[model samples]
Target: MSEGASFRTYFEVEGEDRSRLGAQVGEQRRRVAARLAEIRNVVAVMSGKGGVGKSYLTAALALGLARRLTRGVGVVDADLKSPTVARLLGAAGPLALSPEGVRPALGNENIRVISTDFLLADGRPLRWREPEHERFVWRGALEAGVLREFLADVAWGPLELLVIDLPPGADGVADVAELAPSLKGAVSVTLPTDESYQSVRRAMASAQDAGIRLLGVIENMSGYRCPSCGSTEPLFPGSAGSRLAEDFGVPLLAQVPFSAGAVEVPSGLLDRFLETLA
Candidate 1:
């Protein structure tokens, strides 16, 4: 009973069709490798829970990096079921695909964008009215399959950075690592609430357990300023970002204030954060 023969025999004994699926999986992995080879750096922008503006932060980072690089940057909306990269960046429809590979749409800042939104039946931007629960309903295997395709099939070309906006949780961590082994680490986002801090702590634990480096923490919507009184009020007072940084042994990158401005990227906060990265 050699190891190779035993492996095959075990699958046969279980009456599972292993060869066909194994070949497909192997090909998908190869495709992922080919695409990742062209990208220099990969970052998984993640959080413990939703509504912390993780996707927006990922977009801002991508745009900022694009502005500094001649080759531009790439962002894959890895939240397959609830993708918002296309809508957040206002990227248009009609994905360009050829024998070479699938082309990611260009955003306002010239950053290349890829999301499951482009793969919808009509290939149009996801509507705000549509409930996310209605769009994405799948188990872990299907979710991994979609992510694998995003990495393998998308024609990212040459990119300074490939910022992946992972969904809120640790389930997809393995898929991201397996698909893109060159991933540098994760940038965890959180709010100023106690709940957010706990969630972020769990996210950090997951990343560390997977051997992924913690780039730093970004505290978004930390405070707001009153126009009439000129008084600054902390939105989530006593933000745990600093404590998280200290406990996790990672830097506190930025505490971005909330703003209603229409700017795609907050220049001041983003600039400061980029400096730390340098």
Candidate 2:
């Protein structure tokens, strides 16, 4: 009878499809690892949620680290949708292509940088041609593929360190750690607020679970300083970042005051980073 027909699951029906997908992913993974192997160390700067100046912190750390090493630093702006590292560090492109791979742009301190923004011109946004519902269904997978491509194809050369400016949450951290075999540790950025605290705490846990050690915490926009008078006032007043570092058994690396000078990386910052990440 027609009612007696056996049912089959999608996995059973599409076993070959799954194998093909796995092989594709594994190929990309191998490329990424081979590329990253040239870099001496890999670290990620991440935030649990956005609007914590995480991108700025990433650029600052890279610049700081570059000064400490002659080999220089590299950055992969993994925020495929809204990348700021390129603009933040003045890595304008149309990137170059070499026999090795796609060469990353040179930012300040000659920071080797790769970002989607460098591919798009004149502040154009990256959007899928698909409809909203279709984008929702496949955007995550698409973004992951884009990230793997960036990691694998960029000609970073040999670097003292590579800092990844991850988009908010654990997904970016996990992906970078997986792609870059020698990933050392990750720094969490947060504001002093309950929302930031809750999200960043979970993010740090996710990073640790992903096999990347929690190196330290950065409390950005901690206070506002008058550019002219040099007086500091409370901005987002709380102990969220300090408490997070304490709870995670990591150091609160710095309390960055919001000011015109804030864009300038403090010289002592690298000392602190080396002490902690060392």
Candidate 3:
């Protein structure tokens, strides 16, 4: 049989019938199993609220791991409501779909990316009118079957790690906790501000409630360092990284300084990310 024909036959046998409830459950199980088989580590980057630089950190972490480690990495932009990994990585290519499954994501350094942006028509607004609308989008994207298809059916190849950039707040944590039990841990991001700290603490608590391990806390825009004088000043006044780490019993991985170059997505931001990883 042709390669495409062979793939179709395999998919038919493996994928459960969409109409049946039992089949749905089986499909979910298969997808989760497939994800477990493929990726070695799955890290969810989350925050209690938006503007904590969660998505930026997710992209940076994936790139960092991929560039430094021999094993490859994939990033799932689980922030369905506001997917931005595609834009961050500059993946504007059309998604290839076949009877076998969806093709591997196209982006910088072979970083496999899947986001709700890929599913939408050009310029279509994803804003939900009601709570149910939001839930449907979330369920469709992150639930077992769709997630499995993204993982199993796609040509992700072998990955050492898969970093998921979830939507900001408790909703994102709940989504991953409900879907994937293999979540290795979460890296909560926060700014050095009183409000940001309180919000991030709540997010950490949500992860704790879900039994997800807190790998560390990353303090973004913690302080500004003067290149000429070497003087440092708090941009947002608060005890965030160390204090929260002590409270939650997790490490303070790094305090990322307020660098305009660090936050920009394109224009050599990947190189800055590598430095941070180092």
Candidate 4:
């Protein structure tokens, strides 16, 4: 046989062991469920669309919750294609692996974190808008595989809360629900515009259809806060969060004012938002 034919035949032999591959995948899923069980609460922070500071809010929520919990909080950057939790929270350390499992890196306030970013190019942190981050283009089954590995392998020990930062849309949410059915719920984040409202409504519907509870909605960048004068200003014409919440029967958890500073979420806003969960 030619080289190409020989290569194909080699893979054909491997494909014959379908049962073995299936068994291995099944066992991996079980391990993932077992690992996630140790965490007290698993909540996915998501948005119907991107560019609404969902990832930043996720990190901030983890930090806030870590302060309240004795065991500390963790964040799984489930945005497989563009993992940012590690970079955002400065948890971009080399992931340690032992016979036990993959060890998550700790960020500020003793909050543990794990992400595909840590495994990139020897754990070098990816700067925002880096060309390297754009190189990855995963689809379909590949997304599911990477997500499963994160849950099954990461050794997150005794976490009070595991906040998963999911990429925009229903696929990411569905993947988490499938792997960890015990998820506490999802906190939808969105902006204060009609455009954002429509997307968030779909997100709420998707979660409900999947039998996942919609905890609440947080309106980020709802208004601008003047740092110099401590005055609040509405950046947009109006907020649709109230109507959206009413339609879904979920509360509008908090209207986090916009910040001109580096962080997307204001300090006080994060604290008040977490209180709603209590």
lDDT ranking of the models: 2, 4, 1, 3
TM-score of each: 0.83, 0.88, 0.76, 0.82
- Candidate 3, TM-score vs. the true structure? 0.76
Q: Give candidate 2 misplaced runs (Cα > 4 Å).
A: 1-21, 129-133
Alpha-carbon error at 2 in model 2, in Å?
20
Q: Which stretches of candidate 1 lie over 4 Å from their true place?
A: 1-20, 121-138, 227-231, 264-278
Over the stretch 1-278, how does candidate 3's per-residue lDDT look in tens digits? 66665445635676655668777766776666665576777778888878877777777677666666677888887776678887676565577886655665767767888877887767785644446655865655544445555545666666787788877877566667556677778888888888888888998998898788888888887788777786777788887877888999877776777665543333343453344333
Q: CA lDDT, every prediction?
A: 0.77, 0.84, 0.71, 0.78
In terms of lDDT, the best-performing candidate is 2
Residues 1-278, candidate 1, lDDT per residue (tens digit)?
76665354554566545567777777778888888989878888888889988887887777767777787788889987678877777776689978878888988787788888776755465343434574555445566777887788888888878889998886566569877788888888889888889988987897788888888888888788566775768787667678788879987877767766543465465555555455
Shift in Å, residue 220, candidate 2: 0.6
Give the C-alpha miss distance for residue 194 in model 2, angstroms: 2.3
How close to the true structure is residue 133 of candidate 3, measured as C-alpha lDDT? Answer: 52
lDDT for 136 in candidate 2 is 72
Tens digits of per-residue lDDT for model 2, 36-118: 88888888899989989999989888877777699889999998878998888888887887899898899988999999897
Alpha carbon RMSD to native, model 2: 3.4
> Which has the greatest TM-score?
2
Cα-based lDDT at residue 139, candidate 1: 48
Error of 2 at 40 (Å): 1.0
